[model samples]
Target: MKKFLRKNRMFLSMCAIVFLLLCTVRTMYKFSIRDYHVKTNKVLGYSPLERAMQVANYLTNLEMQKLQKEQERIDFKYCGGPCRFINVLYIREQETRAQLHVRHLAFTSAKVNRTLVLPNVSGSHLGACKSHDFEYYYDMEWTRQNKEYFNSIRMKDFVAWIRERKEANVPVSDQVLSTFDLDTHVDPSAVTHCFSGLTKPKSTFNQILKWNITGQTCELSIQAREIAMVQFLKGPSLGNGMNANEDIEVLHMEIYKANQWSQMAQSDIPIPYHPAVIKLADTTAKSLGPFVAIHWRMEASKNTNNMLPCAQHLISLLKRKKKFNFFLLTDYPHMFTQEQQEAAMKGVSSTSELSQWLQSNSDSFLMTDFTREHHEAIHYLYQHDTFHVLETEMERGGTPPDHWQIMQIPDRLKLADVDRPRMIDSGWLGILDKLIAMRSVHFFAGQKGDVCGRSKSTFTAQIIDARTIMRKSRTNYFGPKNKTL
Candidate 1:
């Protein structure tokens, strides 16, 4: 073998060189796949509905990716100038989603540290959604929780803040915000088309690379780089990852920090109940001991006389065991506009039938009675809200409303002033109603959309109704109907 090697040394050296070259090529290929998740890539569509659903997950995954990249390149610091902050002002469009978006975006910012700032969202886009109320569940819960964050700056103040930073030689992100939509046209009807398997947005990191839309895009060249902020602003669900990455660990840590900073105290953002609401709840709890809290969704569907059946079932279930007070929190679809009610109920029984049944049901408490009782709460909330608004204004270096200005603010709120927090009173009232319902002993909820009802019932005052037991003891559920094994 030695003689043969000596004879073919030239051939052997050539073979070794080829082998090394092949190994290098293979390593490069593996890394390229690692840096860009090719398998997870897909086409993204331009639909508002898809946009809303995907935004949360997109932001979440983007933060995870960016955090990972930042850590990987931690020691590889660039000698670039002072990094900039691109404040992504929280805008309350459809306020429910808007609040969620704010929270999600904040979480992303915390993890990625691209220095994204969220401006306080002002104004509820009332009557904006096709399938919901004028001022659907926009509440003070988010703003109150993030009071410190919102108080940080205003629109003009933020602009000035960025300007000052720029002057002081601090890099401020020029590309503060970007929309995901490749094309601007949002055909409301096209959302349905996208879902019909006909179209889907191009959903890939490479696609984002193609578009070059992100905070880094403000600073870095739009070659072939992954910008975490851009990934968040756009993209569908982050393709499911198999192995948990270090980015996830950082994300969890950031989330913990964020929660610690923003979780509101019960007293700080109290359920906007009038003194009478507390009085009513206290009086009722004292007299009735413990009751059942059930939220009926009759307002969602006209044929949802399901509430009547559920109520009767509740009564039948509890009547024999104990005299249970039923705190029923429900929406009157009939109260909505004709289009809204129709959409909610989809040609169910007229409001009169449901109203008549509710009126006749001696066991039921009327929503109107609840409203009359909580009028003081509604009134008090306005004063509380106006006070906060003034405080915010004052914080922004603006004049606070004078005592007379506050006093002159009429007890009666109007549609004209709906732009402000006055319209939010209804949302506050709705939350109060839900909380009251949850204070019940045993809850009876409609079987359909069981998740919604079950979620509410979990807060019951054994508090564990069938639903709660199912949620907590459901693993024991399949085992036996027996409690004690």
Candidate 2:
């Protein structure tokens, strides 16, 4: 028995070592499991993998919320609605009157809780249907910031929304685009709802669904599923008994009444010139140093038949204020060269007389007298490719075609014939004149029978109104009681 035990001793030692090692491994594993559970238990009773999943879910929710907030902000700025819209058509009017028209329509939109679709601005009365961006004439940034006063979206944005609706298969009834000429008396009960497949003519959205106002009345209210587009045939105007169209005056009053109902202050209405134009005017005014601006408006004057008296009256007025330089803004052919002036005089005898008067008053500066750099700046800022196209088409001895046709011409070919250096177009030049006249130390306009006599022109009225709003007066420089000469 002792010999057998000695022989098996090696085997017994090997088995014992194996058992001890297994026990040590099992104990170590058990402690590791317990430590892992303890660490996990401290973290809201979740295992490591479960806790990681929980953190991922929390971050995802935060991201989702952030995306939602961003969408809401975009919706507010661009007016992504669940809402209705109103657009104005400023046809057959100059830009000054058109600007007022827009303001009145914007007020109407605000009062009715509708988004105003800003109309395209026209630089020429002839091209009333042809339009440029709202920014071409006014400060769009100012408009955006002052959304509380005028809630609006650009013409392009409105068009995009319409296209999106069509793509999304929004019901034809839901996407109704209608036009209405607002009546003098706004009867809330006279609501009209129109529906049609959208037809955009010449890229003007307001002309989208041309429905005649043959029997329509003042108010146009659409159903919850529909959108409304209202166009004004005649725009709101200030009623001073100078014009017989009291209908516009009534419309203007309705807007004010709506404003009163909505608790909007009249002071909140925005000024109508582009910020760049205003800035340029202010700078030029400072450099001119106490100059008097005279808006002769010879084209509108009734005294054009016998302009010698009118010119004499203006000359005498300037003689009285001889201490200050004169800035003349007239519709006559004042910017023509000697050869051009002679040619123009041959066409219009009255223009020749007005030109001689303007030429005699050499102290008076015309817009052409501005620096070439300043003229270039005006050209660059307000010049549109469309203007160049129109001018080119006109110079070729043909009436300019529709906007779309003009745009279809290759971009390279449009400006080939245009004289890019000169501010030749009346559209941009009118704006430049307005801004310069607006910033003058003393402003003078034609009164009926005064030297610069004419009917009550919106151009003159706008300048006076702007000056009043800006608190521009002769009193600022210890001058006379009247702000206008």
**Which predicted model would earn the best TM-score?**
2
lDDT tens per residue, model 2, 347-453: 44354444442331112245333222222221221122111111122223222222211211111212222344222244555665677777777876655543233
RMSD of each: 24.1, 18.1
| True-vs-predicted CA distance for residue 256, candidate 2, Å | 20
| lDDT values, one for every candidate | 0.34, 0.45
lDDT of 1 by residue, 362-452 (tens): 1123533322212222122223222111011111222222310111112223333145433223233333344444454555544434312
List the lowest-lDDT window of 10 residues for candidate 1.
250-259
Distance from true location, Cα of 165 in model 1, Å: 11
Predict model 1's lDDT versus the native.
Answer: 0.34
**What TM-score does prediction 1 earn?**
0.33
